[model samples]
Target: MSAAAIESPVPESVLKVEKQNKGTVDALYKGLSDGGDMGKVAKLIASDLEWWFHGPPRCQHMMRMLTGESSHTKFRFEPRCIEVVGDCVIAEGWEGAQVYWVHVWTLKDNVITQFREYFNTWLTVKDISPHGCEIRHENHNHTLWRSHPGDLFKRSLPGLILGI
Candidate 1:
């Protein structure tokens, strides 16, 4: 069976959340790219926001971009794909083969409270349930999304092998 056919349908509520999350993420990127509307960007994120990074020290591109330490021209974060899994909005992108990035934004009341950035690494989002664990069966972990390279490398063999 086809993958789409095998997968269950997404609930309407989830779709609505995904759309709203996508819009928020898009607006943040647009504000950064325009180099104006810093107020709008500020409104989207929380005052005491927490951020985490898992990559090279020099690859703190998102933090630098949001903090005005780096200009849009220096490193633009145009997300190739944006997905909402539960309360997190995941955005993944890449700049050629060298740089791959994934940004996980957690929002509450439409304001981003936490940001997790992954650079030059593959990411897989899964939903684990402790309640599903039984005597013999392992805890259920349903995969929500996976990071993928841009169209340029998608069709290549190495990209397929690496699944990035």
Candidate 2:
């Protein structure tokens, strides 16, 4: 048999753990969608949760809703795809396919310890059993703030120059 065929797949226990982690994240999302409570989510996350964000701070409008800073938050966050690989649960969220956000959750003991947010970027997670991991890319399109901070600045350049 070829080496590819002889290679062993991921263990069943590991797969179960991954599925459980994904389910936890899904419930968190559902809670947020149903306006349940943020305190509950806090419990699911680690006390020292690490959050990483790309693009300008102003474009992080979702933070307002997450932090209870804005009661008029209209945007809804729902995962289009979720993948559990290794010890991480990666969720790709989108609103009507125009805006996208990828949330990477690194969990320890079923509590989220680290979180990474990649706004306006396509995300992919791969499992390389008996090895490491690799990431792939894809094309994405969105509005100014939803696309990139630089794009927002560029769109406002003409107004800035004309002082209008």
Candidate 3:
């Protein structure tokens, strides 16, 4: 027998990758759920990481809109903990108000390297190097403020009167 034992590399990583992938999914989901902090996310994601979703024009557009001198907020499907491989994670889940997004992620040196995402709300990022992260909501609905519809005006009148 040789000094090195024979081993199939892919299977070796399966369990670990799945766990990492689950953690990744959970981290993003917690951020997207709103009412949470984005900084926690920055801490979780490795600097050289990129996330992508290919649905909801808002997925990308909103990200830009919300990004600021302080970019905060994140959104993604509530993924199903499906499979894992060393440095790779696989999951299926919903994105947007009602859509599906499937993804796989690879990590090296505790930093994310490649991300394979499928669906309409897709984004590709590289050299992530997150200094920090923030969390907020993805409001994908008709603007309530634009029309100033009767209901909204009614809702505002009370606040206006109260100077609130």
Candidate 4:
């Protein structure tokens, strides 16, 4: 199924949270791209930011952007898909065929507190909630977003071959 088709019905309250989170993420990206008010970007991100990276060590593009080591003109991050799952926002984008990225931003009180970056790697985000005594089960898990099949194959092939 397509990424957009994975969403299940959600309450209005949840939708409101998603909308607010979307706006925060959008503003962050816009500010980064425009090279505009970093104070605004700083406001969106928490001081004690938790960051994780997957794929090559050299592919820390987002960290570089955040640190002012690289400009958007050099490496722009324009997410083609953005979705909210629980308290997290997932943004996916690609640059040509060789570079695919997924950013997972976890927010608390509308400020991004955690970031996980995946470069040239396929990602699937699932929401798992408790059901009575069970902490996780197939029925309790809901897929929120998935990398496109075409993109997944292209990005995952090398890793699969190398058993990475």
Which is the leading candidate under lDDT?
Answer: 4
List lDDT for all candidates, in order: 0.72, 0.59, 0.42, 0.73
**Candidate 4 per-residue C-alpha lDDT over 1-164 given as tens digits, one digit per residue, 9 for 90 to 100:** 89644555556776787789989999999988876557778899999999988889888978987877876567788988887766778788886767888888988789999998887877766544443321122333355567653454634432211010
TM-score of each: 0.75, 0.67, 0.44, 0.78
The alpha-carbon deviation from the true structure for residue 139 of candidate 3, after best TM-score superposition, in angstroms, is: 42
TM-score of candidate 3 versus the correct structure, residues matched by position: 0.44
lDDT per residue, candidate 1, 1-164, as tens digits?
A: 88734545566776676678778988998887786567888889998989988888998977887787876677888888887766778888877767788889988777899998887766776655343331111224455676676654543322211111
Q: Could you report the Cα RMSD, in angstroms, for every candidate shown?
A: 6.7, 9.8, 17.6, 6.6
Judged by lDDT relative to the true structure, which candidate is superior, 1 or 2?
A: 1
Higher-ranked by lDDT: 1 or 4: 4
Ten contiguous residues minimizing lDDT sum, candidate 1 = 155-164
Question: Residue 129 in candidate 1 has what lDDT?
Answer: 38
Clashes (backbone N, CA, C under 3 Å), per candidate, total: 0, 0, 25, 0
The prediction achieving the highest TM-score against the true structure is 4
